[model samples]
Target: MQYSTKTKFFNKTLSVFMTVLSPVILLTSVQAKEQIPLSETRCLQKSGYQPAHKFSPEIREVTIGNQLFDSIFSLGVKNFSEYKAYIVCRIPVNKQSHNTEFRVKFGIKDDANYETAKKTKVTFFLDGQAVESQILQIGQIATQNLEVSKNNNISIEVTCTQKLYTLDYCPAVEFVEASFF
Candidate 1:
């Protein structure tokens, strides 16, 4: 069989386009099935103590977080060792699920305010909507599983109170684990 010159050129262009499109489609599928690590995403903005990657005193960093948690990276509020801190983490749609659960566990790993132990409250928000809030004490850890379906400009905000009892005893707020699966 013989083809016209126009038909021949059209066939070649379509072939090249398909080749380019194949990799992109495959990559997207692979990434969608994977877990999204909140710690790795880190904090986008914070009510400044430092960068929100400051792990608490009890946290030890390794390729994977130590004996207790499976952290992809060490993530805590402000590396400044603040007694009180607020941090925000955002996940671009490419990194989030259109429908899935955000699972997390954290607490006031700070020993700084052990003496006064004033009322400590932690609130979590998903896209500016309060999903969970808890009144916690030092050494208390809280866990949450939030159902998220947002596919655009998604974000997680962590707000807490960590009144310092002593000048030198400031501990950063820490999250042992946070992931979307």
Candidate 2:
């Protein structure tokens, strides 16, 4: 069949539009997943010398160099040989017959002494079971995917041992962000 010049131009335009729009639509759809927050319950390990540090519920605006961050928990422990902080959050899941996978994204705030305190370790637990653990430095960001048959609670525990127990300067760990999709 023969077509007019206007029809031919419209067909070409439609083809180009689809080629450019397909990936954009797909990307937007993929990025639209709901992110659940897991920073409601905070627990700190008790120390022999002093009681555990309190978890600050107030979100503070922090600026490190050129980057700015909103931190939900700021844990600063001073005059201690070892410190531990725990952040527990319960994640709700759909009651499906099959298992589900969730992507957890979290980061540690950038500290001035992060380079000196390289021995700080952060462990992630799901349903009171250890899922992943890593030694974190300043400005370290991490992501992990967990597959479970049912919904459960998750926690991030940070442990740091200071080389010097002086009251001058102590190592600190700040939880900047924690969300799951």
Candidate 3:
């Protein structure tokens, strides 16, 4: 049977509509954006003496799910008696969350194994107090400073509320210039 003009026109219109719609859908899908994790771009630097004899500790990173508690690769000690051992931690924004807290434990090690630490000469300060500070327990990029007496050697333990991330690495502790009497 021969088709009517009205029916033929309707079919043609529908075909053209679908042809145009399909390409728009495909093009829009191809232009979709991707989601990526937060990142940082900066470096922190500091210098100090230990004891002249170098003590390198094999530091390890601890992870709890996607979050990392410690971001240490290694800790070094030199000129042990000249100055106090201090841990200067720089938390980059890309590696931290807002309004979250993290805990950092400081310890002094006499051996490379980090089995026993001299806890007597160790003290933690947050902002400016002798007690364990809670500033790092939450999420926010900050620099936390903890000081320890220059024992033989030592390392700082860092932990955070969210997954620990790294932007850069630097010395954990430094010593002041000593005068030979």
Highest TM-score: give the candidate number. Answer: 2
Steric overlap count per candidate: 1, 0, 17
**Which pairs, if any, clash in model 1?**
52-78
Ten residues in sequence with the least summed lDDT for candidate 2: 39-48
After superposition, candidate 3 runs with Cα above 4 Å error: 1-81, 90-97, 105-120, 133-181
Worst 10 residues of 3 by lDDT: 172-181
lDDT of 2 by residue, 37-144 (tens): 544333444333455564445678664333677766644444355555666555656433222455554455555454345455667787899988876555666566
> Candidate 3, residues 40-156: lDDT per residue as tens digits?
112122223433333233345533223344433323323233323444332222222231232333222222222122112333443334544332211222333323222212223
RMSD of each: 9.1, 7.8, 16.0
Tell me the whole-model lDDT of each prediction, alpha carbons only. 0.53, 0.58, 0.32
Give the local distance difference test score of model 1: 0.53
Residue 116 accuracy (lDDT) in model 2: 44
Best by lDDT: 2
- Model 1, range 116-170, lDDT digits (tens) per residue? 3333555667766666776655555677787765623234443335544344332
Clashing pairs in 2: none
Q: Tell me the deviation in Å of residue 22 in model 2.
A: 18
Q: Which ten residues in a row have the lowest lDDT in candidate 1?
A: 71-80
